[model samples]
Target: MKRQVIVYKMEGSIVRRVIPSDNSCLFNAVGYVMDHDKYKAAELRQVIAATVASDPTKYSEAFLGKSNEEYCSWILNPEKWGGAIELSILADYYGREIAAYDIQTTRCDLYGQEKKYRERVMLIYDGLHYDALAMSPADGAPEEFDQTIFAVNPDRTIGAYESLALNLVKDQQRKRSYTDTANFTLRCGVCQIGVIGQKEAAEHAQATGHVNFQEYK
Candidate 1:
């Protein structure tokens, strides 16, 4: 007869598990910093820099690499980027973990009009170049049309909506006749919501529970 030895511990590319009690020290620190007036966006950047500098091996360029410039540009100039810089930053931070988490932003940009004018500008996970397709708004309808969808990568340590800035959405729509601004309603793909003119979007919402909507004038 042969005796077998059992292993209790395992290590991998990311984190190792020890089955220990949870600690709230890091959480406290995050809250404390956020509560302070000195903790501006620039200050957060400094803190991030310090954290990365102190642990080069853990936070190498290859590990935390992202197009911060592009993201920032979007924040300052959304018209050019189509989406906000904050969204891109979030995507840059969280995009890589999509496969593991099974949760990534589903962004879309619509161009042109009528059926033939519709186009899909983007449909991708944040850190990856591969694109996935969702059924168009016209999927089950009489016509099949395409639309652009670009997801905002969330921060790995801090998921989307954690930042207060995300809540500060300026609902502004330009009109040639009137100067009225309107805020958009955010929905998830997993919800049972329906769109008036787009069946694909409604079907997508039913399947995903959350969906993003932006009407152009």
Candidate 2:
């Protein structure tokens, strides 16, 4: 069998590659970044609603333009999405500095929260969509990027990420996105032989009719 390679170059170092399986990309991105895996848009909406409601003095219309009732309804609706609003509430809740990166320019763009000394996390934007990127585990692949930090500031803008800078996002776009995998082993459950990655795992499964797969620590 032939080997599938992930093309990687020096641009912006990504911590981890999170593919958006659904519209919950923004929520998933945030969850994956903070070690917070709660990805339901409605559940996320509820969390923020309660937080904002508890303190109208801190979370104001400046942050939430719509009334609490209306805002809650909007986020709960699957059609409505999450972005900076959700990021800010979460940053405040977690007491971390969330950095929002505008990939178009090589700068560490806007951030959430005014207070300094907070730990940082990353959030990426293509001008229309949002996703999460973080540092790979210590035992991960692409050794060069193991310690890359993705600190972002929390900021909100509608329709701001519609236009993506291909050059900036090329690394995390598709199959190539798996470029830097953390140190783990993908083994074929049937053969007990180790394979390199997802493609190999799929090919091995197809050729040997082995559907069972496992990842080892």
Candidate 3:
């Protein structure tokens, strides 16, 4: 993928590579940063399922918000979305910190930060989607030549790279790039019933088994 890059104050341009809008966007975004392959979503899902299954105590029902068996099965489902738990597990598995910058709140959630990982990768979360952040050599460089993994100092400081990411996220926020899931209007694709917010969408799905929804402006 060749995306137009955003020039940061640093040497190269930092760009957000848009991941597919499929349900596996989070996994694909992580995979893109880890190995430059977006198609590893299925493999990553399997890894998450296996990792959770291997340790019931660490990933207990109280922690996972569901039974271990059920959570494992649910994570393996293609429609299910990956979140904080999956990010932490994958961060441990890869031995790198995953910094997820939210455009909605301009908050950076660092997974595996406590482990003191030497390397870190960035992901942009727009409330409803995840995109990989990479540093390209130039403004129009190809994504294959971009650098996704960055080094963190032993003292836990990332220097200018982290600032670059946060600035980019702030720019996106200024542009209203994030979806406000709590207030966004959605229409069920199954029955065409209008819904407000993710809570209502989930409730409608549970009550009437309508899972497909599209956001409307």
Candidate 4:
């Protein structure tokens, strides 16, 4: 889908900052919101690794689906992608709540919400990739003037902001903005082998040691 800027009523415009799809989009997205730098993937990976290494019981094998050592090592790899666990850790580390909106499901998963963080950031997950959400002063305003972090409160302002985000997501959904990973076709970039869906892609990768795959319409 073509990149587009969405307006959020009279307050400002809700824009999606397209992050690089280098398998580190999640980290890059988080970095963009936190520091306005999308190239901090390596540093974010180290942050996750150090956080996991510092506490094993809290991030055990049962919860991480792998040993603490293995998980930390895997997370540090630039090819490895971060997900819910990384989001949770980063939320606590940065002392802010993260609200990730899934384009496929229109569901908002709020991490560190129970901790009652004073601020929150937003992200958009399109099945396989992640992008950050920021509010600009105008529909075509420069991103440097965008506001990525928002205050979290019990007042209606927070509710209105969330509503605007949801509406933007719904608008994207109508434009077919998300990838349907379950049915999307992928081609092995290394061997030019055709694969269907994420399950088949993983199987093909494990069987042929081809880690490069690209989605094809």
lDDT of each: 0.28, 0.57, 0.92, 0.90
Q: Is candidate 2 or candidate 3 better by lDDT?
A: 3
133-197 per-residue lDDT for model 1 (tens digits)? 22234324321232222233322222222121112111100112111122223233334343443
The lDDT, on a scale of 0 to 1, for candidate 3 is: 0.92
| TM-score top scorer | 3
lDDT of 3 by residue, 1-217 (tens): 8999997556786799999998899999999999999888999999999999999999999999999999999898888889999999999999999999999999999999988999999999998899999988789888889899999986786878887888899999999999999999999998999999989998998899777788997
Question: Residue 211 CA error for candidate 3 (Å)?
Answer: 2.2
Which residue pairs in model 4 clash with each other?
Answer: none
Clashing pairs in 3: none
Q: What TM-score do all the candidates reach, one by one?
A: 0.20, 0.52, 0.93, 0.91
Model 2 Cα lDDT, one tens digit per residue, 1-217? 9999997543332454553645566766666566645365556667877877777766666668777666766666654556777877777766666666644443444455476533666677653356665544443555334432333324422211212223345544533332223333677777898876556765787689775656664
* Clash tally, candidates in order: 29, 20, 0, 0
lDDT of 2 at 175: 31
What clash count does candidate 4 reach?
0
Instruction: Name the 10 consecutive residues with the lowest summed lDDT in model 3.
Output: 7-16
